[model samples]
Target chain A: MTAEDKILPKPLVSVRGLRKFYPAGRRFPWLRSKPPILALDGFDMDIFPGKIHALIGPNGAGKTTLLKILWNLIQPDEGLIESNHLADDDTVLVSGEERGFYYRLNGWANLVFFGRLSGNSRQETLSRATQLAERLRLSGILNRRYQTYSSGERQKLAILRALLQAPRLMMIDDLAKGLDPQATRELTDILLELARDGMSILLATHRLDLAAQMCDTITLIHRGKNIATGSPQKLSQQVFPHRHYRIVLSGDEVTARKILAGSITSDIEIKDGHLSAELVVSDEEELAKLSLTLAQNGISIIELSSLEEELETVYNHLLQDSDSNDG
Target chain B: MAAFFIRDLQIWVSYRLSLFLDIVGLVGTALAFFLLGLAFEGYIPPMLEQYGGYFPFVIIGIAFFGFQSNGLYGLSGSLREEQLQGTLEPMLSSRITPLSLSLATNTFSFLRTLVRAVLFLVLGALVFSVDLSSMNIPSAIVVLALSLPPFLALGMLSGAFTLAFKRGDPVRLVYGGLSVLLSGLYFPYQLLPQPLQWLAHAFPLTHALSGLRAALLNGASFSEVSTQIIWLLGMGVVLLPLGIVALKLGHRKARRDGSYAQY
Candidate 1:
């Protein structure tokens, strides 16, 4: 067992046999009798305290639905959701929609209103909102009307509103949707700091790289069902059995290509200027054999490293597997 | 609730032009009534004679209608706006109870309508030469106070429809139209047919307006308008619980269907 798994805490929120179905085609008068679309089917997951849990999935995979149910914004058709700290003042959901704020009001006003609604005194709410706006680097735009702010600014304001209450459990859907790279990095650092301070977060996103970087555990769902749940490394190993390597050559580009060409032992791709090539071997022994082959052909390996299994690759593979199984 | 009021006030203030135009519209409405009253100066109905002229009767009608409209439509309109703006889900997720949310959402509109109604009355008495000497202020206050709950209940019912269904509330539309047409907003209910008058009595607005007119025009005391007040209170007794139940049921249905945030 890994050291990371040894000290895992008990789940703060436990959801079991969660199911939701939405009636389909009510908008079409001719298709009124269609069966409902099953959005969540026996979905089960546990969100531990003080950990960043990522709910990663494709579109229509029930991530948003689950978040909505957790936030008490929607009712599940059937489920048992037991949470230790689901109180209104301690739990918040930062939805992806940018329309949550009152456009006619400025960001500061909206934040103060949201903070007060979360059960803070007016003076305290204002102080906390100001502090949060400064932390998010949004103080400059805090007095501007919500409609006048850019999408990124609006997103930051939304996050600031949620953070004003210092919620214990925050369910964020697509948190980095409209943020620029710098803002995304800043928000990510802030989230990590919050988690370290014992705040539990359940983040739903299609940004697999971010999930892999920050999530302590990831629950991958497909078609309303959980396909896998584990540490990034464990899930990647399970999904990707082959060993992949990227080798940068110091010799002539054509020479490296000739050495790798028609190689039945591995799949190789010559990259830019043929100086670099990626090789996928079925096993560690096969990788060693390929490196030896390149050397025997006068190809000097300047740099060689095993490619870590990426969250995106694991996600795609699992999804394809599910698709084939359904088919 | 105070947060909701402050937030709504801030938003309303930001739309300065709309606020300015609202007062202009109220003035324009009073002006139309003034011209109409001048044209029918000598043709006052016998029922309106105690009021001294058609102007007082029409001004009171306009004022009461403004209040009634706010009661019947304010909450539903607020709910619709929140849903369209995608703020309803977050608001619902707050610690506030559904009943409190409903009341808070309508607070600003209610206060605004109250101010407009007072302005209408003041402008009528000052600029249009409507009389104020014989007005029974205490009884009129009682009538207005008694009229609130039933109309608020009706507003909640309409809000329930908006919550359950994203489209317009049919109950609000039909009730608002019938109240305007048959509740003596412009003329006395006696002008309607006997069957229509019976239909009008079913509405709390009919009793409310009858009581308000008696108090404000005929200088009627509490005892004189007790029957109308009793009827209005009875409507409140029945409709308040009904409306609360409907709103709860609609909230449940919306959550079930995942339609609470739908525009």
Candidate 2:
């Protein structure tokens, strides 16, 4: 593309060519004779303003490393990290485990302590904590010692501590780990509200369902590198190539195959002695056309379900591609 | 010593500046020690004759020993506590500057140690019939106040070592082993071997304790202890900046090694 034609939106945080390594072997790092193992090797991603960008990978895929670097808990060995919003008070990193707080202190005391650390007044932190805790359903527990909190409640308290800072960018690792469905929903809604209020969140999670539900863009990572980055639908298309639907029919599969023969990319499979067929549709237009053609025919659809939301399919496909490329 | 040094972890967790319990504990300790000194009052050695007896001299010795511990371990010990408690990364990432954090920790340690020393002296006078009515208060204050920077500088260096390696700081370990032996905490440095007495002069606490004994016990003026005061000021001038630089290097090294939260 010409320079004039190449229009790109600005990101709140931009990263490029990040690299980190840890010395291998059980000996001390400096004395270890083995070569270092790369944790983040030329990793790259961008976080747009007000968008939830997800980093999904297997264990040891360097999601935590990236978040730590962004939070300045650690620095990358090599990278260009550009962000004016990365000051100590302007950004925050919330770790998944709820172990960072002073357990002996009660929730309000802990909040006030961390708030002062983040450069906020005690009164301001208390006011903000009152509002945020109510939304998190943790208002009653503010007076209780942190060590007495339940596991999920402890995580919520940590989240509340982070939110009290009112950071411009928040990098949360494992957003849904150890959280129940109701708590996850509540957190998701609060996160959405915050994003709508113009806070950029870079979430690292292994939960594909959560990413698909809330992330505006999903960045699939593997082996310290970005394999793919796009909207969930776009990634699904990139990995899946087409949509698969399992159709249970009352009539014979022969009639359905005849109707969908030229429309579908893959062969219709009959399964379970029931007249059910799995067909791949190229796009929404073709899917609609197939449905209309089936209805026009004398066959009745017992059950029709789209497998587009099967994000596991996307992960497996992309990971296989990445592994193959590595090999 | 490692465990006792981190008693400041309570202050860290509470973030309370009052230290009321610490003072109460210090008073109890002072009273208990006064009883011990009363028992030993009859067996005063010839070297302790000028200082009035064993109680005043040894009381100055141990109380200041605790103060020196505050200066040496307060910075690193608190950091080690945060590291173990998993708050180091968050605290480091907060808006608090390293200068502010160091000053706050060292100030708390110094103030707490100062209060402990004063309580020991006050209790020695009121309850133990130890006369300090003729003591050079300004000289004692100057000696105590000037002694803090060198100790804090040493603490910062130890803190740097703790940050870089995460544990087993040689400054804390070696000094802990040697301070009570050579810095005249339990006995006079003149009692040590000639070579060890020469080595003891290198300890800032040795100068501080010696000056304190002369000022508090002998009522020596500041000019009389000018040699010790100059040594402390000079050491503070050199080591304080060196400590800051070392701490900065240690933090950078830890960041580069990606071990900020590995403890």
Candidate 3:
């Protein structure tokens, strides 16, 4: 590492106007050709220092394509990617679902082989592999042939190989793939720990619940473009601007319904002629005022709670909006 | 470099039956040549008289020509194997340059071929009783040293085509087939037609086999084989750079088209 003072506050990876189009085979000459599918189009993103960012999208949303571009494995037809000067050589790495491993070699042998290829010394690689294996709980399987390892174990091995040198920028795709819930949680915790230790992580995942739990920032992509990029809460606000409140109270149903219906949008439930209500308020002030008015009307509140919008809901809502617009 | 060799050595040693067959095949092939040479001893061509007999002459041809073919096929063969095993892309993504990777991938096969070639000569002398051997060892080594680059260069060109097209390699299919027939492995060069011999001169192996047979059978000195050495070196000079350029072009095209991992 160079002098810490020299590190730039600018984005570590600044991507702008990226575009990629895969070629489709042509056979018919008499008819006009259909437009090719755009895998990435005018996409832009910025990864800052020591933060966990996620790329989340539906199928065919180009999340994998974007990560492949960022890793320099695939070149975009048009784009500018200003790499972070501090990240060079083995300082950056990527882990994907690609089974680029020797089937006959034992797990430890593969790690050492790949570690050396990544510019690590043999002794250094063995030591690091042992440490990482223990951490990943893969120590038990290190002696087994790679072909015999389970899918979850295989993914962990990929992560272990990626972490052999403690890269500053690590990109992983298909996060939580082939992993059990416990393994996914363990992986997420370690990723969070790595980020806290000043490693910037970029993960492409379909699991919004896990992404919301782990990522500091989430970017929703659709049709090969970024449709939304922000914190989970900020994106939820973008989807659900009004706050949702649920309350159960013994009150005059007519009066409560009259005020809520005129002033806000709400749902009221009645069971055995008893009233419970849910309302959408635009702001904290509105929620507070509604509480006061209910108290003023002798509506004793038995239960009241705010409903937080989940990342999955926000992701789905944004995708729906994007699809509607495209349609 | 050591890693590449060790990785392949470990894997190659793991296949016990294949390893057994390798030894059997080497001795068997040399034995066949010795028997053929014995049967045709009295009818030896005048051009081969200086080489003592057909056994001594043919031994040098098969041994060194096999070495040359190893360099020609080892690189692209390893590449195809790795690509099928899904291990090629990761190595391609590593810190090593394409040049180093290409050379390193072939290192194990390179030395293995040299060892097999030396053993082939030993078997001919020990079991076949070819001759006491007035071989100029240093001259033979010089010819081998001069001859390998062009074959390896040809291997790189073949591997470059495999890397880009990710399918049938025209370079290897056409070049490898022609070299075996033209390199004078199983026959004397003088037996070929005039126009064919002219075409054979363009291949480095023709000169390489001639130089090796002369050094081993006739005890030709380094200076005596200068013409063959010069031709081999010239081929190396022209082909090595061309091979590297073709490899770079293939790598770039594969990256641009996103076909590196397709195979």
Candidate 4:
């Protein structure tokens, strides 16, 4: 066997040639189409022992479907998913969706309900619920009904419920949504610690910053297909060239744009009476030279920063690629 | 299985106060009927005379029917309510088997129904001088046990339809109509017309009620009601698996068709 195969202490989970398609409707059942609405056309990805894989995509991009499939929330129409981690990896962790909790129940009750469902004994489930409440800083309001909790608190409770299972593979759907800056940072840190403790994490989120900070690898999905997969830095450097600098000048925007026309080889836009030009420069020295020239030209430099393209840019790029390829 | 059971317990505790109110309401209805029976004791003889002067038999039927009715309501009713609130998928995705989960979900209703049935039995007899003392209490218990599988199975079958077809009233109507006509709640099977007699015989609920009445009211021995017991057991054995398998398959079908969460 290969070294890679040997290192997979247990086969965490495997998805082979997964396919899912939804028929349009029963009224037009006889009306045929060339292809069904392929939610997950053909997906192949392995979540190994200790990696936080971020699944980033736009809305309707099939990230949620893939997570659902892996969680076995619903079976795939045409695929084989086998896991050596059945007793261990069987937990389907999800957050921020309305259905993942009982609204009438308090946070602790909901946790205990799920813990027992995950095969914990009553005593064990209760203890774990208490522990989770304390850890998530929800001890103060663990007795309050979930409906009365704020969106972020509910999301945290959902995460806590999932954590009570001590899941082998934690699948967080869109956790960063509705979280403030500090909470998001704390969550990222917790995820990182979970990863360090040998749990595989699959986070689906629109926020690229969280993914960059926490995830070891990233999977970019667009329109139900795996478009790109790589490490965060690799994907960033490959997809987003560090060759551009954004110069924000506060002045008569039209005149600033006219002045920067000499420096602009790419696109430029004027917003809120400010001229932000995307200029290509090799290094900081060239950028500094351009900054001085702009200063000399009476363009008050309100802000100057290195413009790094994010996963969103890559997402839109892949979308444009698909669109033009179809055209 | 124990874990699943306790899961049900925790779920009940979560809504314990609201469930107490519902229990009060159900038991209150039965109590009102008992009081009305007291005020019009003379008019209730037809009900007592036709069913062997044992008001508990009638009470048991009503209590069981109330539970079965609640199960039907809970299955279809919770489906609609949860579907509207978009909580269906999360509940369905839990680690517990859907059969076990359904039982757990209806846990409070089951206890409420059982409590109401027993209270009505005691209260109805006190008011109407109905005889519930029986020589064959074990046989009566056996009959109750035998009837549960098919009753729960039928409840699940209705629940499966509710899971798939949200707006269709046909499933509920079929179950309600059959239970009323055949379950021997209001009258004896012999009192029904010939065609309806056969229909009642075909129903497991009828056999259960008959078996309970024979043991409790007629002082029938265990051997005497064995045939009815076997019939109840047979329906349970057959329909329980059928109902569960049908629901699981239907669930998968809906999920594959991408309408698993459809309202």
Q: Name the better of 1 and 3 by lDDT.
A: 1
Error of 1 at B43 (Å): 3.7
Q: Model 3, residue B120: what's the lDDT? A: 86
What TM-score does candidate 2 get on C-alpha atoms? 0.88
The deviation in Å at residue A86 for candidate 1 is 3.9
Residues B1-263 of candidate 4: C-alpha lDDT, one tens digit per residue: 45434545565666778778876776676666556555765655465664444345556677667666765666567666667756566566665566875676566667666777677666656755557665388887788778777777777777777766656656578767886877788656667789988877777778877787777666678899999989988988999898898778667666766565677
Off by over 4 Å in 4: A1-16, A28-35, A46-49, A79-91, A236-242, A245-307, B1-28, B31-57, B70-94, B102-108, B166-171, B258-261
Ranking by TM-score: 3, 1, 2, 4
The DockQ-based CAPRI class assigned to model 4 is acceptable
lDDT of 2 by residue, B74-120 (tens): 88887888888888888888745555666666665676677677878
Please tell me how candidate 2 rates in CAPRI terms: acceptable
Top-TM-score candidate index: 3
Candidate 2 or 4, higher TM-score?
A: 2
Of candidates 4 and 1, the better by TM-score = 1
> Per-residue lDDT of B1-263 in model 1, one digit per residue for the tens?
89999998898898899999999998999999889988987886787787777778878888878667887788888888888898887787785776787788778877887888889888987887877778899999999988988998898899889888867688788998988899888988888999999999988888988888888878899999999989999999999898899889888888888888786
TM-score of chain A, model 4?
A: 0.73
Query: What are the runs in model 2 whose C-alpha is more than 4 Å off?
Result: A1-8, A24-32, A84-88, A246-256, A262-277, A284-305, B1-43
Q: Indicate the docking level reached by candidate 3.
A: medium
Give me the displacement of residue B144 in model 2, in angstroms.
Answer: 1.4
- For model 4, how does the per-residue alpha-carbon lDDT over A150-259 read when each residue is reduced to its tens digit? 76677777778778777788899886788888877777777787789888888999898788767888888776777677787567566565466667777666666666
lDDT of 4: 0.71
Specify the highest-DockQ model's number.
Answer: 1
